[model samples]
Target: APDSGGGSSEDSFTEDSSTDVATEDASTLIPPPQLGLYGTLNQLQVDVSRLPRPDEYNPAMSSVEDFQTIDIPSDIKTVAYYLQAAQILPPGEDEIRFSRQEDQLAGGLVRRELDRSIARYAAESGDTATLTMTGEVLAPEVTSLEFYYFDGLAWVTQWDSEMLKGLPQAVRVVITIRPARSANRPEMIGLTNSMTAIEQGDLVYSLVVQLPLAEPPETMGDSAMEAMGL
Candidate 1:
C-alpha cells in the first residue's frame, strides 16, 4: 500500500483561484475517492521471553484489553508487521498461525532479515528513530497519530502516520523512530487525543502523542513524576 502523504488540504489553495472565471474549470472541480472508516491495523508482537515483564491485563474491558499505540514511520516494514499483528490478527483468525514447522522457521528468518534491512536503512537515512512506550488504548477513533516534540518555546511537530484498519482498541505503543539516528532531534513527547467517536460500531479513541528527542529535564520521565507525585 502507498502512503497518502497526510496534511491539511487548506495549504493547497492559491488566492488566484478565487477570481471569477469565464467558464467552469473542469480541472478545479474533481470528486473525492470512496474511502472507509478504518485503515488496516499493522501488528507487532513482543516476545514475552525477550521482554523483562509481561503487559498487565485490563479489567474494565473484556473484548479488548490493554494495548498501546506507537508512532512509527510508514516506510519501515517492521512497523507494518507490528501494526498487522496488533490490529489485524485478532479479527481474522484469533491469532497468526504458522502452517508448519518449516513455515515458522522461514518466518523467523524473514523477520530477522527485515530487521537487518530496517537497521541498515536507518543508519543511512538518519531521518527516523524508534521509541517504545508502554500501554495501549482501544482502537482509537482518530484519523492519524501525530508525534509532537517539545522545543524550548513551544511543542513543535516531529512526525505523523495514518492509523491502519482493524487497529486494536488496546495495543502497546512501541514507537519506532525511523533512521534510528536522525538530524531532527526530539525533546519531549506526548500522544494526541484528537479523534471523533464512531456513532455506531466500536468505540474508538486515538493515542496521538508528543515525545522528547532528548531525555527531558529533571521535571519529566516516570521516576521523576513518581517523586513529584504526579
Candidate 2:
C-alpha cells in the first residue's frame, strides 16, 4: 500500500532536479561588456618664447629707434600707439579668441602691422593711416580631422593629419603683422578683435580625448559569481 504511488514520487523528484538545473544555468551566464564615449578639453599653457619675433620692417624708416622722432599725423599716431599696446596685453587677452563645442572648436588671432605703421609715420607727417593686420594660425587636431575658420566672409576648411584621442594635444598659434600695400589707405583685416581695437586673427587649439566607460567593481563581482556557478 505504501508503494502504490511510488511512480508519482519518482516523477516529483525528476521535476525538482530539472528546476535546480535551470537555476544553475541562469547563475552561470556572463553579462556583455559595456561601451561609451567620453569627451574632455584640457587647457594648455602656451609659451611665446619660442615664437619668432615680428620681423617685418618699414623701408621708409632706417631703424625702430627712428619711430621716436617720426612726425606721424595725430590719427595715424594714435593707431600706432594702440598697435604697440596690443603686444603687451595679457595672454589670451587681445591676441587670441577661442570657441568650443562638443565635437568642434575654433580659435582666432589678431595681428597688427606695427612695423608698417611706424614706418609710414616716419615717412610722412601729414598722412593719416591705420595698421594692417594678417593672421597666421597654426592649430592641431586628431589626424584626418577637419575643422573650419571664419574667413571674414565665411567659414573655410581647415584640416590636419594629427590624430588625437584620450590625451591632451597642444596647438601653437602664431600671429604676425606685415606692411600694408598702400599708404594712408589701410583697411581692416584679419579676425575681428573682441577684446581690443587691434586687428586680430586666430590659431586656437585644445586637446580632446575619448575615454571608455568605467566598469563598476560589483559588475565584475557578479560576473565572476555567475561564471563560478555561485
In model 1, state the lDDT of residue 99.
21
Stretches of candidate 1 above 4 Å error?
1-143, 159-230
What TM-score quantifies how close candidate 1 is to the native fold?
A: 0.21
lDDT of 1 by residue, 117-144 (tens): 4333443554221111111222222222
The most accurate candidate by lDDT is 1
lDDT of 1 at 109: 7
Cα TM-score per model: 0.21, 0.15
Error of 2 at 48 (Å): 12
Output the lDDT of residue 130, model 2: 15
Candidate 2: misplaced stretches above 4 Å? 1-167, 174-176, 187-230
Q: Which run of 10 residues does model 2 get worst, by summed lDDT? A: 18-27
